[model samples]
Target chain A: MKYCENCRVSVRTGRETCPLCQAPLKGESEHLFPEIKSVYNQFILFFKILLTATISGAIASVAINLMLPESGLWCHYVVLGVICFWILLITAIRRRTSIPRGIVNQVFWICVFSGIWDALTAWHSWSIDFVIPCTCMIAILALGVLGKVLHLPPSDYLGCILADAVFGIVPLIFYLTGVSQFVYLSLSCVAVSIIALVTIFTFHGKQIRSDLARRFHV
Target chain B: MNQIRTKWNKLDNAAKLFPTASTRAETHVFRFSCELTEPIEPERLQAALDETARCFPTFGYVLRRGVFWYYLEESRLHPEVMPEQRPLCARLYRPRAKTLLYAVSYYGCTINLEVYHVLTDGTGAMHFLRTLVMKYLARAYDIPEENLGYETAHTSMADDSFRRYSHRAPIKRTERPNAYQLRGAKLSESRTGLIRGTMSSRALLDAAHEKKVTLTAYLSACIIAAIGEDMPLRARKKPVVLDIPVNLRNYFASDSVRNFFTPIYVSYDFSRRDGTLDDILAVVTETFARELDRDKLAEHFCAFLALEENPIARITPLHLKDIVMRTVYHNTIKGYSATLSNIGIVRMPAAFAPYIRSFHVCNATNKLQACVCSFGDRLSISVTSCFTDTAVQRRLFRRLRELDSDLVIETNLLDDDA
Candidate 1:
C-alpha cells in the first residue's frame, strides 16, 4: 500500500522501485553500491573453469602418455582444449556478452596462443623472442591501422615506454651512478606505476563524472 | 625568446591562446593586480627597471595571436600607439614600466602589468611581482644575481602549484532545501544564504583551532552546513567537497611565481549529519599538507606552462586562438562551488601599510564567478552575476553577515562607492 508522492503510483513498500512510476524507492540508496561486490568474483569463476579444464586435460594426457610414451598425448589435450574453446566461443558469440566479458575472453585467447606458441617453440628448441616481438609489432600496427582501439601502434607504445623511461631517468641515473640501486628502482617503479594508475583512473573518472552529471542533474 | 620560437611547431593550440585568451573575453570586466617589493633604494631603481623589463618573459609582444597583428615593429610614438597604456587588444610590445612600485592608482604611478589583467592571471602576475622585486632588490641593495634568482636547470615544483583550480570552492555546512523559485535573483540575495555572525581573523582562527582545523576549513564547514540546509537538492550526498586555495609558498618552494599554486578541492559529505566544525578541519588540514609534493607540483607546473607555451597555437590567428581558449574554458572542471583566497596577515613594510589601513579581497567576473579573499583577518566576499542581475551583488555582503550571528562586516563597494 505504498504510493509515490510525485508519481502517484502504488508500489510494494519494501521493493526498491515503483511498479508504475519506476522511481527508485526509498532505502534503495544502496543502489549506489557498485553492482560488482568483488572483482575477484569474476576471476574466481574463470579460475574454477580454467582449473577444471586444465586439470582434466593434463590428467587425461598424462594417463595416455603413461599408456603410450611413444605417442604424443599432449596433442590430444590440445585438440580437446580447442574443442572446449569453440564451445565457449560459440556460446559467447550467440549471446550478447558484456564488453568486459568479451575483453576477458579475448585476453584468454591471447594467453592460450602464448601458451601453445611457447610449447611448440620449446618442442622445436627455437627462440621465440625474434619471432614473437616482431609478429606482435606487425599485428598490433595492422590492428591499430585498422582502427582497433586495443591495438596501439608500435610508435605510440614506444612513446609511453619512453615517457615511463624518462620518468625513471633520474632514479635510473642515480642507480647507474651506483647510488642505492634498490631505492632508485623502487622509486622508478613508482613513477612507472603512476602512468597506469592515472590512465585507469581518468578512464573511469570521465565515465563516472558523466554518470554523476546525469544523476545530479548538472 | 628564440628557444620559444624554435619550439613553436611543437606547441599546441591551447598554449597559443593562454596569453591573449586569458583576457576577460567571456565575462563583463577582467580585474587583476600584482604586488612588488623593493629593497628600499632610490639610486638603482632605473637600472633595476631596465634589467627587470629585459629579463621578464612578459615584456615581449603578446602577438594578438588570434589575429595576425604586429605592434612590436610599430612606431612607439605613432598616433595610434599608447605605449604606456595597457593593451586593449593583443599583439603589442606594450612595455610595462619596470619600477618596483608602478602606481597607476596614485600619480607618478604607471598603468603597468600590475594594472593589466590581460598580461597575466593572478598566478602569472605574482611571478612578475616576485621577479620585479627580487631583481630590484639585487640591483639596488647589491644582492647577488642569485638573489635576483637563477632558474633551476629544472625547478622543483611543489605539488601545491599544479593543483586544479576549484570550480566551486565549497565552504559551508547544513544547507536547506532550495525549493523556492530562483527568479533572476543571485543566490546571495536569497534569504536562505546570509552570513549570521561576524568573526575577525583572530576569532576565526581561535574558532578553527578549537575545532582542530585551520580558519579557512572551519569557516568553510560552517558555511557548508548553512548552505546544505538551504540546498534541498544536494542532500543525497554527504561530506560535501570544500575547495580551499593554499598558497604554494606555504607548501612548496617555487622562486618563480607564475601559477606556482593550485587550489585543492576537498570533499566533506555530511551524509551522516555528523558534520562539525572539527571534522571538516581534520580532512582539510590533512589534504592541505599532503597534496603539495614536489614531483606532482613540478609535473603540473611543466604541463600547464607547456600548454601555455604551445608554439603551434602561438602561430595561429588570434581570433582562432580566442575561439579555442573559449572552448578550453568551457571544458574545464572548475574545482569547487566557491574558492576562498586567504592572503593572510599582510605586512606592508610600514610606508605603504599606512596609506592602506585595511584591504579586502573582492573579485567579480562578468559571468558566474564567486570568490573571497582575506587579509589581516578582514574577509572580502565578491560574487559576480550578469550585469542584469544587480540584486545578487547587493545581497551577497548582507546575507553573509546574516549567517553568522557574531560577524561584523563593513563594505564600501555597495552603494556609496558607485
Candidate 2:
C-alpha cells in the first residue's frame, strides 16, 4: 500500500497517481491488494462529454440570440428541447434492459411530448385525435405481440403491458369530455385497450394480479 | 426421467427480520474475502464453487416471501462467478434480479463472497469460504481433495438450531432508553467506507495480556473510549451501547449454516463516571460474564421466538408484516450506537495455509461497525461506516498504534485527510 501525501489517504491498489487528486502518490507500505477498475467509469466519461456539449450549445445559442434581436426568444425553446432530449434519452437508456417495458415507455413519452408540442403550437388536436391514439394503438399491438413472441415469463412483462393498457384507456376520457372531435382513433384505441385487458385477465389473470401485488408492495 | 420434488425450509428465527427490514441502504449483507498469494484463476475458482455449493446446500437457496412468512426454496440457478466491480457489500438479494442469495466474485488475488444475512451468519459464511478456498487450492496445486476433511452432509449444515433450542419459557421484554447515536453526513448512495488496519496478532495479543483482558474485550473498551472522546456532554446522558453478536455455535452443539446468534449489548455512560479505558473494560468484562451463559442466551432467543409465535404475527400478510417489521427495525436500530462482531481466528488445513494471505469480514451498516478476525500472525480489523467522517476510526486506530508502531492502514476513502 502507498499513501498519497497530497490527498492524505492510503491507496491499497498501488496506483501511480492518487485516485482523488491525480497527483503522484508518495510513501509505500505493505501492499494489501491490487487495484480494481470499475466498468462505470467509461459510461461516466461519455455522460460528461454529452453534458459539456449540451451546455456549450445552450450557452452559445443564448449569446447568439442576444446578439441578434430577430431570433425573439427562440433560445429558450432550444434549451428546453435539449433538456427534453436528455430526459428521454436517459429514460430509454435506463429501461433498455427490458424490451417490452422500454417500448412502452418510449410510446408513452412520445405521446406526452407530442401533446405538449401540439398544445403549444395552437392546439390543432393532432396530438389527441391522431398522435396519442395512434401511438397507443401501436403500443398495444406491439406489447400484445411481443408478450407472447418474446417467450418471457408472465412475471417479466405483465406489469408493463397492464400499465400500457391503462394508459391506452386514457383516450376514453378524451371522448367522454368531448375534447376529441374525431372519434375514429379514440374509439379504436379504447377498443384495443379493452381487448388487451380482457385477454390478459382471461389467459394470465392470476399471474398479472400477483405481479401487480409484488410491484405495489410497500 | 423422473420429476423430482424440491424442498423448502423456513428461515430461522434470527433471519425473520432481514427480509422485511432490508432497504436499499441496509440490505443486511456481509462479505468475507480471502486473499491468496497470487491472482485467482476464474475457471478453477468456479469449479471449486460448484463443489462447495453442493457441500453447503442451504446456502444456494433464494429467499421468497410466503403469505405468512418468508421461506427459502432450493434454486436451480447456477451461481454466476464474476469480477468484483461493484462497491463493497452492494445489495445482493434484490427482487427478481439473479435469485441466488449469495455471490462469488474475485478481484486480483482476493476471492470475495458476499452473502445476504438472511441465508447465514458470519460463522456459516466462514465455513463456506474456507471450504471454497481449500477446494480451489487443492485443485490448483493437484493436492488430494479428501485432505480438506470437511463434513459434506446436507443435514448437518442445514440444521435449524434456533428451532431445537426454542422450547423454553419466554421472558418478558423490557424497554430501555435509546443509546447515544453517531451522526454525520453519510457517503453517497449509502456506500460504506472501509478502513482496515493490518497488524501483528502477537503484538496485539501481548498488549491485551498486559491489560489482563481478552483481545475482544480490549478492543471493545477501546471503541467505547473512542466514541466517548467525541460524544458531546449533553449526548452522554444516554449510555453508549455496543451491540456484540455472539456465535451460539460455541455454546450449542449444532452445525447449522443458517443464522443462529444473539446480540449482547454493553453500555457505558460517561456522565456517571470519569471516562477511562480501564473503567470501560470493567463494564464490558462484567457484561460479558453475566450474559455469556447458556440459559441466559437461550432465554434471550426465546423472547424473540415468542414474537414469531404470536397468532397475529403469524397470520398477517407479508406486506403488512413488512410495514410492522420496518417500524420495529427502525426502533431496534435506535437502541444501539454501534455494532462490533469479532469473528475470532480463522483456521485452515496446513497444506493450504501458505497460499492464503488473510481473511476479512465486513457487514453493511448505516452505523459504524468493526469486524475483527485473525489469521496466523496477521490480525485484520476492518472498520465499515456509512458516515463520511473517520473520527471514530482514527481515534481507535491511533490508540492501537501506541502498541504496534508499524500498524498498516488501508482505506477506500477518496481522500485520506480526514
Candidate 3:
C-alpha cells in the first residue's frame, strides 16, 4: 500500500501520486481497479474527411455555376443531392445494429428521396412506377429471406416485415391517384404485400398481435 | 410450435424518469462489486452468473419502448460473464436494443454487477451481487448451498411495489431558490471518476454516536462541509443541498427487487448558519427527522405517483412525455447539489464470510455522488464525479481520515502526466 503523507491516506493503486492531493506517496502499490483504455473511434477522421469533401464540392459547384451565366441555376441539384446522400448514409449508420430495422428504414428513405429526385427533374413518374413498388417488394422478400437465414426469432423481424408489407401497399395509393403510369409493377407490389400479410396473419398471428399490443400500449 | 406468452411489466414510479432523462454523461447505471480473498475464476464465475440469472428472472428482461412509456419485456438473451472491459458503470440500456439491462463482469479478485437504474436500485443490485458472490464461492470452495434471506418467488421479486402502495393524496409543491451547482470541466467522453475510501465502520459509527447523529447524517454533514469550504462568497447565497434516497422497502411490506426509493433534500446555507460540522449535522438531523416520517414519505411518493396517474399525462404520446419529463427532471434536479445513498449493511451466511473481503457501491452521475455500503467492520464510501477537480473529494477524505488513520483510498483514475 502506498501512503500519501499530504492526504494522510493509504492508496491501493499503482500510481506514484495520490489521486486526491496529487502529492508523492511512499511504499509499495496494489492494483484494485483494472486500467481501461480510452475508446477512440477510428471512423471519426474518415467521416470528417467525407464531410469536408462534400461541403467543399457543393460550394465549388455553386461558385462555378455563378461564374458561368449560361449554366442556369443548377447548383441546387448538387446541394440537395449531397443532402440526400447524407440522409441515407446517417440512417443506415444509426440503424446498423439491427439489420431488420436498417432494411426497413432504408426502404422508406430510398422511396422518398427517389420520388423527390424525380419530381425535381421534371416528374418522369419513374419513382412512383418503379422505385416505390420495386423497393417495397424487394424489402419484403429480403426481410423474409434474411429472417429465415439468420434464424431471428419472430419477435425481432415480424414487426419489420409487417412494416415493409405496409409500405408495399402504399403503391396502391399511387396506383389509385394515377401518379403511376405503368400499372403492372404497382399491381404486383400490392399483390405481394397482400400475400405477405396473409402469410404473417395465418402463421404468426399471435406473435404479431402481441408485438403490436406491446408497441401501441398506453 | 405454440408461442409462449412473455411476461411484461410497467416501469415503477421512480423508474419512469430514467429512460428519458439518462444521457451519455449520466447513464443512470450503478455498479455493486464484491472483492473476494482470492482471484476470480472465469468458468466458475460464469456458472454462478447463469444460476443467479435463473433465480432472478427479472434480471433477464429487456427494456422496450411503448407508445406511452417504456416497459420491461421478457427476452431470451442470456447475460454472459466477461472480463471487465468497459469503463465503470457504462451505458446498458439503448433505446431499441434487445440486450439485457444488466451486465456481470469480473476483474482480478472482484466481481462487478452493473445495472441500469430502470431495472433495479442499489438495494436490489446488492442482493444480486451477494448471490453471485455466494454462488461463486460455493462452487470454488465446495461449500453447501444456503438461503440468502431474499424473496425467491419470481412474481414477488418482479412486483411493482410503487403501484401497490400509492394512495390518493393531494400533491404539494414547494418552490425554492436553486441550489448551488458544481461548475468545472468534466472528464472527456463523459466518463465517471470514482474514488473509494474504505475504513473501519465501528470508528465512524462511534463518531456519529458521540455527536448523537445517524451515520448517514454525519456523512451528509461531512460532504456538505466539503462543498461549503469550496464555495465562493457569491455562491454562498445558494444552499448546498444533498439529495438522500430512502429505500421504501424498509417501511412497506414488499419484497420487490425493482426501484422503490424516494429522495429527500437536505439543504444547508453557509451564509445563514455557522459553517461548522456540528451545525450542519444538526440541520441534517432535523431534516432527516422531518423527512423520514412514514406518512410524509408515503405522501411524497403518492404525489409523485399522482403525476403518473394523471388522466392527461397518461394519454400523451411517449415522445411528448419524454420531452416534458426530461425538462421536469432537470428542473427537479436543480433543487439539489449532490446525492448521498447509503444501502445500509450487507449480510451473508457465516460459512461464506471468510472468503469475502468487502463490498463497494457507486453510481454514474453528472454531479458528485457518494454511495455507502458496509460489510462486517469494513465500510466503503465510494464517491463518483464527472468533473476533473478533486478538491471536494480531497477535503471529504481528509475529514474522514481524522476519524481513523487507517483509511485506504483506491481510484480508477490514472496519474496525470506532468
Superposition error at A37 for model 3 (Å) = 0.8
Error of 2 at B277 (Å): 1.0
Better of 2 and 3 by TM-score: 3
Task: Report the error of model 2 at residue B286, Å.
Answer: 0.4
Which candidate order results from sorting by lDDT in descending order? 3, 2, 1
Worst 10 residues of 1 chain B by lDDT: B1-10
In model 2, the Cα lDDT at residue B341 comes to 96
The TM-score, computed over Cα atoms with residue i paired to residue i, of candidate 3 is 0.98
Put down candidate 1 lDDT per residue, B279-340, tens digits, no spaces. Answer: 65566677666765755444444555555445674455555655777676544423244444
Classified by CAPRI criteria, candidate 3 counts as medium
Which model is ahead, 2 or 3, in terms of DockQ?
Answer: 3
TM-score of chain A of each: 0.29, 0.76, 0.98
Tens-place lDDT digits, model 3, residues B1-418: 5354667888899999999999989999999999999999999999999999999889888898888889889888889998999988889987777889999998999999999999999878888998999999999999998999988898899889989998897656768679999999888788899999999999999999999999999999999999999799999999999999999998898899999999999999999999999999999999999999888889999998988888888889999999999999899989999999999999999999999999999999999999999999999999999988888999999999999999999998878621
TM-score, chain B, predicted structure 3: 0.98
Query: Who is ahead in DockQ, 1 or 2?
Result: 2
TM-score of each: 0.39, 0.72, 0.98
lDDT of 2 by residue, A1-218 (tens): 67656435455644465543456776664434433344344588889899999989999998999999885777887787788789799888877756777888898888988888787778998899999999888987887778678666565566677888889899999999999989999999999888889988987787667555543332
